[model samples]
Target: MIPVTRRIAIDERELSETFVRASGPGGQNVNKVSTAVELRFDVAGSPNLPEEVRQRLARLAGRRLTLDGVLVLRADRFRTQERNREDALERLLGLIREAAVPPPPPRKATKPTRSSQIKRVDEKKRRGNVKGLRRGRIDHD
Candidate 1:
């Protein structure tokens, strides 16, 4: 089991991994070896995730998530398959941990203080006066 949080633990069997060829850093092995790891987690079907967490995970997954609600992560930053696999797993866990955090409460609508509003108007009037001074004087002979 992979413990995401004190309340959330994910079963290892819930995850699926696929190995594919990665294009980077491994001169000869890059072409022959499948070093990239593709990790998939079914957020929709998982019994471990709460409904709210599942929804947040889907939102956070964005394009990486399939229409069927599976989260996909591709890791090819490393040359070795083991490193790539671990990288993918770490990324998946990080995403889950992020999703687990509750969103901050919505900000309440607030009116500007009376003094601030007066100050803003005063500044605008002052700016207008300064610009008005910059204008050339017209003669009335």
Candidate 2:
């Protein structure tokens, strides 16, 4: 089980992992050994997550989430499969933990103060008057 928070624990069985060859740093060993870890979790079907967390997780996953609602994380930073696997699991846990937090309340609408409105108008008028002064006065016949 992976504990995300005091109230949320994800079952280990929910995670699926696959090994694939990684592209960098291993040299000859890279061609022979599969070091990359692909971790997949079904966010939409997980019984461990609350509805709110599930929704947030989906949004947070973005392009990482498949059409089937599975969250895919690829870990190839490490040259060893074990480290890559751990990295993938850690990333998944971090994402779930982030989703567990509640969103902030919406901001209330506010109107400008009467004094501020007056100040804005005054500034506009002052600017216009300064520009108007740049014009040459016309002589009356």
Candidate 3:
């Protein structure tokens, strides 16, 4: 079991990893070795995740979540397959941990202070006055 939080633990079997060839500069070795790791987690079908976390995970997953509800994380920063695999697993754990946290309390709506409102009005009036002064003088002929 992978411990995401005090209350949330994920089964190792729940995760699946696939190795693929990494793109970008790694000399000729990159072509020969499949160093990139694609980690997949079934967010929609997983019984391990709480409903709230699942919803949050879906939101956070964004494009990473497929139509099948699998969360895919690709790791290819490292040159070696082992490092990439570890990176992918670490990233998966990080995402799960993030989802496990509760959302922050909503911010309380606040009205502008009387002094600030007055200041704002004063500034607007001052700006209006400046613009008003820009008007050309009228001819009294």
Best by lDDT: 2
Question: What is the Cα-based lDDT of residue 53 in candidate 2?
Answer: 97
Ranking by lDDT: 2, 1, 3
2 against 3, candidate with superior TM-score: 2
Model 3 over residues 7-107: C-alpha lDDT tens digits? 89999999999999999999999889999999999999999999999999999999999999999999999999999999998888888888888989999
Better model by TM-score: candidate 1 vs candidate 3: 1
Compute the lDDT of residue 97 as modeled in candidate 2: 93
lDDT of 2 at 94: 95
Off by over 4 Å in 3: 109-141
Candidate 2, residues 18-125, lDDT tens digits: the string is: 999998677799999999999999999999999999999999999999999999999999988999999999999999999999999999999999999999998887
- TM-score for candidate 1, residues paired by index: 0.77
Candidate 2 Cα misplacement greater than 4 A, ranges: 110-141
Worst 10 residues of 2 by lDDT: 132-141
Looking at candidate 1, the ten consecutive residues that score lowest on lDDT are: 132-141
Q: What value does the lDDT take at residue 72 in candidate 2? A: 96
TM-score of every model versus the real structure? 0.77, 0.77, 0.75
Q: Give the TM-score of candidate 3.
A: 0.75
Q: What C-alpha lDDT do the candidate models reach, one value each?
A: 0.91, 0.92, 0.91
